[model samples]
Target: MLEQLSSVFFDEANELLDNLESQLLTLGDNPNDSETIAAVFRAMHTIKGSAAMFGFTDISSFTHEAESAMDQVRNGVIPVTGELIDLLLKARDHIRNLLDAGAEVPENYKQVSEQLIIAFKIYVSKNGGNASLNQPVKKDVPKIKKEDKLSFSWRIKFRPSKNIMKNGTRPELLIKELTEMGTATVVPFYHALAPLSEIDSELCYFSWDVILTTGKSENDIKDVFIFLDDESKVEIEKIDLLPGENNRIGEILVDRKDVSREELDKILKEHRQLGVILVDKNMVSEEQVQSALAEQQHLKSLTPGGQVATPQSPASTQTLRISSAKLDQLVDLVGELVTFNARLEQEAQEKNIAVFKSLSEQCGRVVVLMRDVSMGLRMVPVSTLFSRFRRTVHDLAAQLGKHIEMATVGAETELDKTVIEKLNDPLLHLVRNSVDHGIEMPEDRVAAGKTSVGTVTLSAKHAGAFIMITVKDDGKGLDRDVIRAKGIQRGLISENDNLSDNEIYNLIFQPGFSTAKSVTSISGRGVGLDVVKKDISTLSGTVSIETEKGMGTTFILKIPLTLAIIDGMLVTIDNAKYVVPLNAISECIAYSMPAEEKGQRFVTTTNHGKPLNCINLREFFNFGKEPPAKQEILSVYDGDEVYGLVVDKILGSQQTVIKPLGPLYGNCVGINSSSILGDGSVALILDVYQLTGLIKNSSKKAS
Candidate 1:
């Protein structure tokens, strides 16, 4: 239970931090957005409470100070300035790290915390003095006024719905809330009870009563019961005001018969401004002002209204905190299920019994569903990955002394959880490359007829069964001369090679290829693009580049939807079967023996007169002698391109759960992973990227 509570605290803390980051970014652009400030305050307050409960005293204290700072902004006591926001953003990161590291913080962190707290205090004090004039001057109590005055007392009762207590509410807590309003005594009303044998522990059966001498009115007391009113009963009545009560505005107004409509209207207008205008204008006496203030307090308790609920901004939509162990467990279960289903199918085929056959078919469907659910559980939206870039752009642009604005789109697109995990590093490299190399300085953009704020767009979308992720920038596009020169200098390309523009652009991914004069910590060391290419390709994905001088450049990535399972076509090679993802197989045709025929167009030929790649499993894998008869050609196409992979037989298609080969064959070629055959044999899942690479190379040799 303690562990779960801690987990909940950290989870909520992380979420609050995300909200804080996003709101801070917006506040940078629109500082007057009070709603955003309120949202930031709420997130901080939630973090403070959760942290306190989880025993992170430092986090609770730090966030309490931060929340107080934000509350000042919300209440119009302070402005949301860029410098303050930057400090707060740094503070958020510090808090996030503290929560993640738990209670065992290093001594070095103490200085940073103290410095942040000092800054927060400075911020609060700077604007704290200019606060609303009517805000209560904290001081000792004064003696009561008698005759020319008025006094009133209020009795209040409250009963909360059972669910309130179940949801972590306590009647004592509510009574304590009333006490905070003014001097009041709490009395427990504990009569509603059931026999022990019939009682439900989760059910709440409690109520409360309170009497108070306060400057606030009856409405103020009733407001405390707003959330509980629907499920509980609440009663409030005015009594004779005590001696001190005559000085209370609420009491004085009631006694003077000034509780009329006209005065109420005047007080409500100046309510938020501290009611000084009403008092100064003599439209409402100080005692009446006190009661009106209490009425406002009651309204505040009802729903805590005053600001709009900010949109479920981009940052919150993308991330989920999950245990890596749980993910591994799920993968293991899916793998076992796939293996078992395969064995069952094999048994049913061998037995040729009606019951066994039906059971095998049912098992196949269940296996498919299981694989899908497991994979679905691992799917995460791309937005979570995108949010981190905001800080990166801000910091890097500042460091480089350049002005750039990063834009994002299609962040809601989803990718496999494992894939997203693997993608972060490569995406980071790409973004850094874009900012450091792709985009230009503010003056340069202006010289190039572009906006001073150069734009770097990071986006993702689904195209067919592939996820197309892109990183584009509208700065100075790839410089052809510089790239060609760098290629020659790095031995990536020869000056006499007559490389096309696309081929030249591809040279950027070559090892040790860079055009920067000096290497910096951020990006220009020439160690990133090559590694990024390798990482992306390892996932059976391809990265392509497009550029136009002075226009911009875009890097497009085409990757499979998920790595775990796919609808695949079973094909035979030398009587050894393999599974090809169905999404990649454009069509299958009968063997016209085109390769053996003369002067005829084959499927292994492209419209550009270049022969398409053909991978003959018999020759490539050396799977013994081929069968006498030629099998059909399974023409798999990715976009407009096609490949003819010749096999011995076409074995139909089925939904197959992809299982990774253990470390023994981690670097194996031709195959990406293995899947379980319905009959229980291990079927190799072909790596389309590797297979196509080999076929294309072989075609180049033959040509």
Candidate 2:
């Protein structure tokens, strides 16, 4: 149980730290934003309290000092500064380290913690008077006995159900929490206990009456019992203690006619409290008296500086944090269900039975809805991925002595969680490259008739079934002469080879290709871009670059929204089936054999009043059979050029679950993965991007 709680705390702590980093970054941008400062302080405070609860003393202690510094900022004692933000950022990172390491302290982490604490204390002292470096500055905690007009006494009756112990609730813990809020005098009642012969060991028979005096709001007290259910009986009332105050409890009871004025007067004449006398005489049960007290408390709490505490409403929707492994399993199951639905639909169509067809169609609709909803559950906003880059840009700009601002747009664009996770490294590489190589220095920018502050924009948008993410920078763009020369020197291209600007710009992604004149610790090694290309390709995504001579460079990544399943156009070639991603297919046109001329087999067609280049897949795959008399050309746009894939026949469309190709076929080009058809036969899902590149390479070799 303790381990489980510690794990939960670790996860919560990490999320809090991520939010802390983001808040600190915002604070750095707008130093005078009080709301952001308060948010930062609250995050730290929550982490500290939760850490202490989970026995993570190291984290708790470190966060306490950080929280104290933030508290100073919150209270207007210390003005926000870049140095303070940097310190807090480091503190957040240290807290994450502690969480990751658990009970074992990482080497030198203690030293770092001590240094940060000293820095925090020094900042606080520099702003004002001498501040203690050893002890954290404590905020004034509200007390029960403070001579404030808002101070009031609460009478609480807490009665646990007979089987409360069976529900794993420790009543003592609740009592202890209440005592911590103020001065609490608890009196236990054992009147409900049965005789020994009839007693149940697992049952709880005792109840308590507590008198609490506190200036704190009633919500504070009720929060202690927030976990209790309807089975527990709890009543709270404010007891009036002012001199000359009327006996409102008795007056209320008499007014409500629960007890008549004559009975109240008779009880009062017996020299006893009205409530006790009524309860003892059975004029009102204990519950009724408690109810009257509650009403009195509610009315009294309505006065100035009084808080009326209402029972917490249950959440209409609750979020359960399921493990990613579980979600992956669910997606896999859903994929299988989708495949089975396709088979059922095919069988129904083949049988031509009206009832079966109707049932199958309805089931198909339900399956489609389920697939969409389940996939949506795995979709999260890209902002979660975008926010991390702010810190990266900040640190990189500072280290490189440059002025760069990173602006993100369309962060709310949603993508599959798996895709976002896989895209992180590639995106990080692109952003870092933009900062290190693409963005020019401040002086250079000014000399070039531009603002000193360069801007790196990261934007994402939905494009049909794909998401297009672009990383652009307003800095020195790609130099055509330098890239051409590098290409020639690296043996990647001939010196006289005429290439479009797009093709030349793409040479940067070549392995071990760097245009940087000097090496730096950050980037001149020329290793990241190639890896970025490879990673993106592994996800069946495409990366393209657009640049000008002096304006800027933009790299756009086109990625499918999800990798689990895809809408594909299944095609047949030489009795074998293949699937083409529908998003990649531009259009399909009827193909007829062109007159053979000098061994040239390509055909040209008109699309949107422009010429389109077409390639027959049968010839490319070398199917070793005569071309089918009837065939179709599937046109696809590959960023720079449009090419056609001629197939033996079009096999209509399919919703396919992609099963990865094994390592034995890892060397295979054009085909990325295989999918199961409705007939239980496998069809290779074509990687159009790879095929286009291969086609280009093959054409070059032939020429």
Candidate 3:
């Protein structure tokens, strides 16, 4: 166990570092949270111990200072302070760099470690120092236990993850590590092994069953597989009975899951070989019987043991950690299945077969259920993404000499993991903007009759099939006149242009559009908000601003829950088909083409006494044929107001698995994506927000 595998150690060490950072951030939130304080100590201690065991001497040596400092916090020798958190955060990052870049010590890393060591010593001296850290800086050598003189028997089952080989592990190395501990009888299981032609060299499908008689403790054996804890399954049973003890064959067979207890009992009553009887009864195969026999023989080889071992306990786990890459692949396969199910249903209707139709209906129902479950798998809580900003807010507030706190609401709101990843930059930009621009200086805030401590609130709530993420700041709002002047100065607008207040607020999203006289790191580069607009646009989401003259400003982002698939209202104009997102639609109403709209891009009509701006789909895209005198108006809400999207006909609703148009048509106005219909026709998905906003603005400016 003391001889460590490099790949395994690095994987686990990096994870510990990430956990260490998160726990430290939580401590920053509630300095008096004793639970968090203890957790931080544990993480630091584990990292230091594991690093020493794995021969990461540099990490172990540097981490010793951090560990002792945290020990001081745990023992109530010192209180947690912002300075302490900052020092530890820097230490965490430094250790991560060491792990990432390997043994090559960069100049900056050396400087950081030296500085951090000095600070850790300060904290240590403040608590009168710890004697334990006085030990020599070297890899920890496990001391021989008293049990090293006493022999015991163990049965170990090592079922490694199939993708273990991808981590550069040689399976034989594990066996070697175990054999070094004692006399081992190893049997390889190739049940999952593929044929040579179909074999994947990158994947490991082999597993091992070992019966070892040794003086080593069970903990030593467990430590050998500690790095594989999440990626592999290991079961070690202390079965120290001597040869010919208590129907060991049946027990071995049962333990291997090759035979059930009831089946074994029934066969044992017949007084024949349990394995043979089971194979005769067609219960387990001859191969399984052989595997069980090997295990039984290995147990017999345990020379007249010292003490009998109790039965192994059942394993219990509440949760499992999985790779995001695997989840993405699973979702891709499910998307294909969903499309195939639609094709099956369509074929059934076309062929007019009753039995086939029934089968298709059942399959369709199952696929729908699977679609829901698969999509749900990607729905991670927003809290994980939000929690990361605590340190950023803390450091930025300190840097700017401002007193601010980031308050989060609806942190439990869920969204697609992919969307959340893309959303990070946009949110980061908005937050930085709020801190640097929206929030005023302490004196200025008091002059404005507001609290000195500014608050930036991040909130999310479900809006139909969409989720609205709002970032609001309780500080000086966007000045309408200042923005207007800036817009005109930057040639983003004209003095002659009669724009609404909302339109003026949106001027910030334009590239290189800023009202600031100078730029800083937080904001005023003029690129952050522009990048926000473009990135959100790619996800088929929209951003809007709500600002009062003296009140604080709020930036609201309305995004679809999952971008992979959507419930769409399929509509057709002449020979072309288009899908309008169901979430954007309010209601569909029949409309007669007016004589005044003969050559117009949009027709202003009335709905419930409100002027509804309607866009004619056929005329806008210009198809081969003319639209019917009677057209259909789909009321589309673009987060601001409801506009009418006039189409030829409405063809109900269906699940649309979105396929991106890629860069070729990325900027092709209005069309967000395309989907394959059940009939194998490609239907374009309309960007309701973009279509309404782009065309509405164009129509207004034209008039």
The Cα error of candidate 3 at residue 462, in Å, is 1.8
What global local distance difference test value does model 3 have?
A: 0.80
Flag clash pairs in model 2.
Answer: none
- Candidate 2 C-alpha error for residue 483, in Å: 2.9
> Tens-digit lDDT track for model 1 on 1-703?
9998788777777877887898888888789986788678789878988888778988887777777677667656677887788888988999987887698987767778888888777766675533232233222332233321222445565667776766665666678877876656455545577788978888877665565545666676667665663566776766433332224444345543556556656566765553466667776556445544453333222211211123466986896767867986886788777767777877888999999899899888888888888878878898888887888888788889888788889999998877887787778878888888888888888887778887889999876557888999887789988999988887777879987687788888988777888877885678888988888866767788888888888988877789776788988876578988888887786654454532222226342465555666666676655344656777777553578777778888877777778868867777877887766677898876567766765565557
List residue ranges in candidate 1 displaced over 4 A.
123-322, 493-495, 595-630, 640-644, 661-670, 676-681, 689-703
Global lDDT scores for all candidate models: 0.72, 0.81, 0.80
Pick by TM-score: which candidate is best? 2
Ranking by lDDT: 2, 3, 1
| Residues 75-165, model 3: lDDT tens digits | 5666788888888898888888878766676787878887888877776666565534445323243223343467677888889998887
Q: Model 3, residue 577: displacement in angstroms? A: 1.1
Q: Model 2, stretches more than 4 Å misplaced? A: 133-317, 351-354, 494-499, 584-601, 607-613, 624-626, 633-645, 663-669, 689-703
Overlapping backbone residue pairs in candidate 2 total 0
For model 3, name the residue pairs that clash. Answer: none
1-703 in candidate 2: lDDT tens per residue? 8888777877877888888889999999999997899789889989999988878888889888888778777767678988988888888888888888888887699888998888888888988833674466666642222244365667677998887889888887888888777656566678788999999989888887676767778888888888886799998777654312344788867744689888888788888787888888899877667766754555443433343333334762466777788888888998998899889988998999999999998987887787888888899999999998999999999999999898999999999999999999999999999999888999999999999998989999876557889999987888988988999998999978889777888899999999888888888788889998998877778898888767898999988789898778989988899999888788888877664611234555666788655566776677766786677878876655677777778978767898988878766777878999888989998877766766566566566
Q: How do all models score by TM-score?
A: 0.69, 0.72, 0.68
